[model samples]
Target chain A: MSAEAPPAEETIASPRPVRGSLPRRLVGRPELGAVVGAVAVFVFFSVVADAFLQWSSFSTVLYASSTIGIMAVPVALLMIGGEFDLSTGVLVTSSALISSMFSYQMTANVWVGVGVSLLATLAIGFFNGYLLVRTNLPSFIITLGTFLILQGCNLGFTKLISDTVSTKSISDMEGFPSARKVFASHLTIGDVEVQITVLWWFALIALATWILLRTRAGNWIFAVGGAKEAARAVGVPVERTKIGLYLGVALAAWISGQHLLFNYDVVQSGEGVGNELLYIIAAVIGGCLLTGGYGSAVGAAVGAFIFGMTNKGIVYAQWGADWFKFFLGAMLLLATLLNWWVRKRAEESK
Target chain B: MSTSRTSKASQTSPASRKALVALSDISKYYGNVKALDGVSLEVHAGEITCVLGDNGAGKSTLIKIVAGLHQHDGGTFAIEGEETRLGSPREALDRGIATVYQDLAVVPLMPVWRNFFLGSEIHKGRGPLRRLDVEEMRTTTHRELLRMGIDLRDVDQPIGTLSGGQRQCVAIARAVHFGAKVLILDEPTAALGVKQSGVVLKYVAAARDAGLGVVLITHNPHHAYLVGDRFVLLKRGAMAGSHAKDGIALEELTRQMAGGSELEQLSHELARTPAPDLSGGVAKG
Candidate 1:
């Protein structure tokens, strides 16, 4: 029922709105650091490596980025909502393993296996979220538990069902051709062949950005992340918002899983063991606060792009790939410091 | 008592404004300890009913019960004269009872517009494509703050930069904007400086003038004396006194706030003996 009491007579305060200048708006963006970092990295690489500017190499970078971007987008949103999913790394492998093993064991159509895997993967996500909410445990601890459990299940279940650590080839299975075309197919743009994952990655990023910027749900994510008690005092559904975020991570994992299985025609149960950190690193580099509350999906996509450049740029420059992790570590630290400076500027400039 | 607790649901005019919220003989127990005993309060539209008490005097417990954060063990809490139980803060909010806590009212890192609409954000469009109406919110936030007599440098600034009083005012303005019928402020001026406290008292008066039933809980009788129309004093989980503005004087209100007879006993214990000849001797030297 609506309030039966008398309504407020008039507005309380009547301050006029100050118009936002272009520069003020630019500085207010959480992604400004990531954008500047991306440009700087792009310029540095272009000058250092001759092949970095080529269309073919650029397409390769996009492809590599897409793989990580797909997961990073949802993970970024999750982080903004004040949580993480450590199991996401093995969860991706588990998704592909389930589809492949189920198909091979049952000798059924690959599509049927894919459907079953989808349901199973989503259940894992639901469990992680439910356990977290019910126990009031940190998402880090809760998801780490799920990660270890899923990691074990993936290996043990695959060995028992397939007699090997990897699933049998699904190339000749029914529905394999269509699934492959949908997920693993290549597109020729100019002289470069681009993976279908790139399209999926772009679509996911656009969807995530729309949710983060526009929806009431996006508002709830920020509220819940920024300060849950304050958000709760205002009647925001804090628990439900957090649970939904975990589910988003699961759905992204499913997409990435489908891509992995279709691309290789086989699934390794041990794959995707340590990719969760890469997703988190990309989101952080993209401007998501590790503490939660402030971030953007567009920033996360740029973060993945940086990862792609660094990964491919080194090989193109003929540098040893051994130093890749060292570079990744340094970039994460620098980006974090840069993001902190940008945030301070935004808060102080006003 | 019968005349004071009129049914609010049928209230019609400013002349005979009914009590919007009434808690009669409310008592709460924590296991064996009495947190609140036989406490009664009445909040009427266009008036501030100040609940004055010192630390551990059940001020927070009383606010928590009225704001739906806690359920009283024994009491009849009537809203618009209808007895009801509030299960959650959301339920209380739906019934037009908004409680602004001392410090936890707003997210400091969020911008003013975002903080203004933290839980109840305004959105447009349909389904997944729906987005925040940023321009609409910004304009509304600006207008609302001005209406509350709060002039901000910018709506885009982080809320943390605002002084404590401004933050409390923003919260008060938010409650008003959302159509709060009964505003319960938990020590709004407790942590503020003299000037800041004055700023908040002005808004409290402003809120009362807008015809809200305000329940202001505080320990400072001087602050309470400024805008409070009725005063309820609590000491050690029990009502020490309750008085209308006409019936009570400022000094007596201060005496009641200091636990009345308890302070008298302490003053007797700490009374100093006379030092008669010390000043004369010093003057002779």
Candidate 2:
């Protein structure tokens, strides 16, 4: 023991100190709580519901998570950069409505509508960002205004064009099959089939994580979120960073929109009224602060995963579906507390 | 730091010791309010130009003019003796005029290394795939801080955890690292403790030694006299006096900063109060 002690001391003393201790690194991760929460939720469901561990059940959960995860990833980044887009939910429905209605009314290929919808959704995002930056208004008010405007337009435009609250089905239109194959196709693994959206979700998570951790733009996002004035003084291009974040949300909405359009063939104008709250809930559950400047994409993904589990876990446990919101609220609160505790521990460790 | 000196020397002849930034009779107005009027000063290379003023003496207005946050309505501002008009902070930065405001322009919650490379992050790769060179930034930040005589336990720690003076020093170091020819520091030590202010002053001196022209704006004459080579005093949005280190004494500078007789009158009142306290309280005891 005495002979070995010298070598151990040499190892500790010979080199420069490591960047951070292992415990410190683990504690510093914003998503540590979300990861723990996800694992606990997964394990709880697996134990209570025999079928919950099955491949089919897993695929179902993945698909459910994928839709919200697509939007949650960008929303997380936006939140980290210190802003919110309350209009995201309605924007998704609006995208779908635009594509479906335009295809049917113009007797055009479904792809044309999809393309046009992308532009329109991006314009909406730009409008939100532009107004927020130009007027110096709180993002809450700016995005809320956008949310209301989009909600009204989604209903008004659908009714004006189709004489109904939902757009006409575009399933039989040209390019429908190809669009469906790309946006709503299923991937077979063993005997279970999972949605293309699940793949999109994973891909986006990977991309957002890379951008947040390994890119200069990621630095700008964190800086802008933490302190806008400071970022600008340091030449962070605050306006462009914010506008770009909003545009990211817009692009994700387009993907979700396409998936919704091709999967269901029609879009109800009011289909996405409350979904924005779900996205925000998933982000918060993942470890994003309501005040911004601290969060991670992977945390948000884990958050959506937890959301997906709870949504299905209740049904699998033979509990009433009405318990979903109750569990979601509970999980959100628990995750936030865990995150705050973890952050405190990280700070204290230093 | 060695590289910074070489660059400055290449741009300007050392024999002449020219001013990097010079403002002559600069004035600004907002409607009926004259924010600044007839202020002139020169920031020479490898020296500190201390701008001292009381509250509402146009210290911030003068800083804004040089930082290019606001344009001067009259008179001329020059860079390297070339007359110029700066439209925005970006243009000012392009002209090598960087300002570190009292706020420091640093995201407190961000890691030290991240905050160090906040806006001007170095990247590798090509096109849209370009990623931050994190290892290089970390190493460079570590090296630069060492050059500034700061040894952090961890660069990964959020900058918010640093003391006010350490943060100020970091901002000054950041400005120096970014190739700032003339640095405008706005009341960096206003909220710091004695020790922290000392730490910041050490860096201000270090920055001056690094061959960069530094503008140290403060209301404290003691702080100014310690490192300033030239002092520019402002009163009522106008220049009260400008003096070289050899031309003025600390007491004289302090008197002018307190509005001449206004300070004497206040001191007289304080002296009378002390006399009453000493005689009545001590005699009764």
Candidate 3:
């Protein structure tokens, strides 16, 4: 049965006043601050680094952005649901390590290892969400515990299986060619070659934006993050929504891990130790709040783009690698302040 | 039990017609504490049943039982002539009972339309393509609020920007639109100004006019008397008094709600004691 009343006569005069002007409405978007920062950074790099404007260099910058953007999109979704996943960085390494070791030990098709890794990685994500809900502990603590366990396993298991700190090359195994083509292939778009990860990155951005803004689960996500008790009282299934968000993060980590393995033919045990902070930083810069319930996937993508630009721009400008962290920290503080100011203006105008 | 004579008489007279919700001698306990005890009330279609009490008078405990947040420990709770205990808020909603909590009714950061359809979102399309019907929901929210005498500047504004009375009205309209046969409101006007309270009570009346049963929990006898068809007064987890509209006067209802004899004792003690010398006390401090 329909839950709402039938439409009334259209001749009835509208009781609501006219909506705000376009610019006023634009300022209310969660991504407005990140877009502004992206534009500013683009201009600054173009002016300082002469090579930054080249199409080839821009493609390199995009490749860098795609790797981080893939993870940041889901992390932003998790943050909007009012939780954290500190285990994501090491979890990526764990996924890759599992896939490589399984394939080499079994002498099976690489696709089987890929399939197994997906299940194991998702289980870890489920474990984190289940512990958080059942224990009533903070998500930070639950995921942090998983983070340390995964980090230890990545090193310990790699050493125990291979007698080294990295996985053996699987480039010559069955199904390796097709797997590499799917995860790490390159496409020539006009004159510049682009990584397949860039395509995956854009596809994820589209999917995430749709889920955040258009689906029933999306509405529940906003509710659970905004006022969890109210959401639960009204039958929003708060626990299920949270668990689903953690699973989204794990799914993305699987894709990123597969890309790392297929691209290099070998997996490093310690490769992704601090990348979780990078993903979190990108989401926050994109306008996701630490407190939850106020962010967008597009904003996180823009945040990743800004990160990619600054990282490569420093090299093009001949700056020392040590200055990269300093620049990123400054950008984060400035973008956050701008987001706060814009949000205030939007509220006051309302 | 002494004050339940009118209720008992009325309950027998209405035996031919069942109430939408009926609670008889309902009691709840927490460990050794009697949070609520031997309370009886009935809500019928197109009627307002006002439960009046002071702080620690077990008003909240009574609401929790009917709203399905907690089950009653003793006695019977019936819905539409069937005796059953509700297990959750979802079960209550499925049975056409909707409760609007005072402080936790709406998520402040969401838009008004989103808040209107928070739990029961409308969707169209198949499988993976299924998505929220945003346009329909927005129009419906605006139309429903307008029908309730609320003219908004924009439904897209964060609900936090709305006045407290407007938020309550929005929540009431949502419950009404979702086909709630019984509406349980917990202190809807407790944190509002006099004008805002009047506005909220008007919506409560509007909901009743639309053929819904309402259980209004409040401490303000004046506000209660303005719209209540039946009054149930609570004191220390027991029924102090219960009356039909024609059986009691507003002044008596106010007196009983203000703790009856206890208020008299308090006033007598206050008058006997002299007013404090504020200037001397301040100088000593």
Every model's TM-score on chain B: 0.90, 0.89, 0.91
Cα lDDT tens digits, model 3, A326-348, are 98999999999999999999888
C-alpha DockQ for predicted model 3 = 0.41
**Taking the candidates in order, what DockQ does each have?**
0.38, 0.30, 0.41
Q: Per-residue lDDT tens digits of candidate 2, residues B1-285?
A: 345545655776756776799999999998889989999999988878999999999999998989989989999998998998889898898888989888856898889999988878889999877899888888778767766777665788899888898888888888889998998999988999887787888788778877789999999999999989899999989999999989999999888987899878988898777567778887999
Q: What is the descending DockQ order?
A: 3, 1, 2
lDDT of 1 by residue, A1-350 (tens): 11111123343333457766889778777777778878887898899999999999999999999999999999999999889889999999999998988888899999999999899989998999889889999999999999999999999988898788988998999999999998899999889889999999999998888887777788888878888899999988888998899889999999999999999988888899899999999999998988888888998999999899889988888899997898788888888898888778766766
If you score just chain A, what TM-score does every candidate get? Answer: 0.94, 0.94, 0.95
Query: Per-prediction fnat values?
Result: 0.53, 0.46, 0.55
Candidate 1 vs 3: which has more DockQ: 3
- By DockQ, the best candidate is 3
Give candidate 1 misplaced runs (Cα > 4 Å).
Answer: A1-16, B1-15, B271-285
Per-residue lDDT for A156-185 in model 2, tens only? 988898899888877878999999998999
For candidate 3, lDDT tens digit of each residue in B1-285? 122334433544555767999999999999999989999999987789999998999999998888888999999999998999999889999999999999999999899999999989999899998999988888888888877667665888889999998899999999999999999999999999988888888888878877789999999999999989899999999999899989999999999988889999999998887557766788899
For model 2, how big is the CA root-mean-square deviation? 5.5
**Poorly placed runs, candidate 3 (over 4 Å):** A1-12, A15-19, B1-16, B276-285
